[model samples]
Target: MQMLMYQECIDACFDCMVACNSCYDACLKEDDVKMMADCIRTDRECADICALAIKAMQSNSPFAKQICALCAEICEACGEECQKHSHHDHCRRCAEACFRCAEVCRRMAA
Candidate 1:
């Protein structure tokens, strides 16, 4: 059960990473790129953190729970930031992905 849960969390993290990367790239292409600078930076950070959390969980590190808790927080913040640009489909999709990943991370942390 524990292994399966960890695998699912890892998968969620990877999915969130992909979504964040795509959203960041799309944001850069927008005409108002400067307005989205913060979003882009946060997306990149969230993706990196998610990846790190997944690696820690996969390795059964003692810090996995703490990492997952932090990941959840980052995911939620990223989601909220992305939601600010809901007019952009990429941002909307990214927000949804972040929310899903946050839920998974929360469960893993619990």
Candidate 2:
């Protein structure tokens, strides 16, 4: 696939990656780190996948579509986890970015 065609998805993935990283850092600093365990884990995982997806798309990898599908799934899961802690600004922003990334990834995968 042409990189141009995947620009939107790439941008979304980048945004999600940043949001997830920020959320992960913020969660670790929260008073109740134990309570933020799931969110922290999900954020890390989501950020990793988003980074991978960006690389795959940038390289025009043959598995780009498949990678995107998995990225979407992980993004959705991360979004749900972040949404649970949405009262926190970082979590809320992360959730929004994850959901947007998931949508963009789904379209790219299709």
Candidate 3:
């Protein structure tokens, strides 16, 4: 029963990780990659944190809630950064994914 609840959060985290990776790659391909430095860095951190959050939840770690809390923070920050470059479809998608992940993480953490 509890596993089912965490499953949803795990799925969201996985999806967000994928979206962040894609967005980071797309940003690097842009004509002005340097302009997306912050986005790139944040996206990478968000993706890594999402993966860690998923793992922590899956293992039922004692610190799972803490990991989810940190994940939510990074996800929100990444979402904001991506939203700033919403002109890019990849960035928009990443932002949406990050927002979704953050919501799920927060719910699970609480």
Candidate 4:
């Protein structure tokens, strides 16, 4: 429940959220938006979950660990999806953030 105890996880969540948002915006601007539908959707979902995980941790919610577990799963999925399009700088950055966030969240959940 101590905020300081989860600072790393919180930071990772925030970073992942930002990266996902950026990826989402970039994907929308891609020439073939239709082909990026899955990536866009996953980015949005990943961003939302990261935001929720941050909130849960900051608020000292009893379910913070569970939320982190779910966050890790979503982060991994998002990382995989973004990695598919790693040729794009935005996607590459997002994939990295998602993977980092997943590792941090997994530690928090443990």
lDDT of each: 0.94, 0.98, 0.96, 0.97
lDDT (10s digit) by residue, model 1, range 1-110: 56676998899999999999999999999999999998898899899999999889878889999999999999999999999998999999999999999999999999
Off by over 4 Å in 4: none
Which residue pairs collide in model 2, if any? Answer: none
List model 3 lDDT by residue over 18-104, tens digit each: 999999999999999999999999999999999999889888899999999999999999999999999999999999999999999
Residues 1-110 of candidate 2 have per-residue lDDT tens digits of 59889999999999999999999999999999999999999999999999999999999999999999999999999999999999999999999999999999999999
Cα deviation of 101 in candidate 1 (Å)?
0.7
Return the top candidate by lDDT. Answer: 2
Higher-TM-score candidate of 1 and 3 = 3
Positional deviation of residue 47's Cα in model 2 after best superposition, in angstroms: 0.4
Span of 10 residues, lowest total lDDT, candidate 3:
1-10
Best of the two (1, 3) by lDDT: 3
State candidate 1's TM-score: 0.95
TM-score of each: 0.95, 0.98, 0.97, 0.98
lDDT of 4 by residue, 39-87 (tens): 9999999999999999999999999999999999999999999999999
- Give residue 11's error in model 2 in angstroms: 0.2
Model 3 stretches astray by more than 4 angstroms: none
Clashes of 1: 0
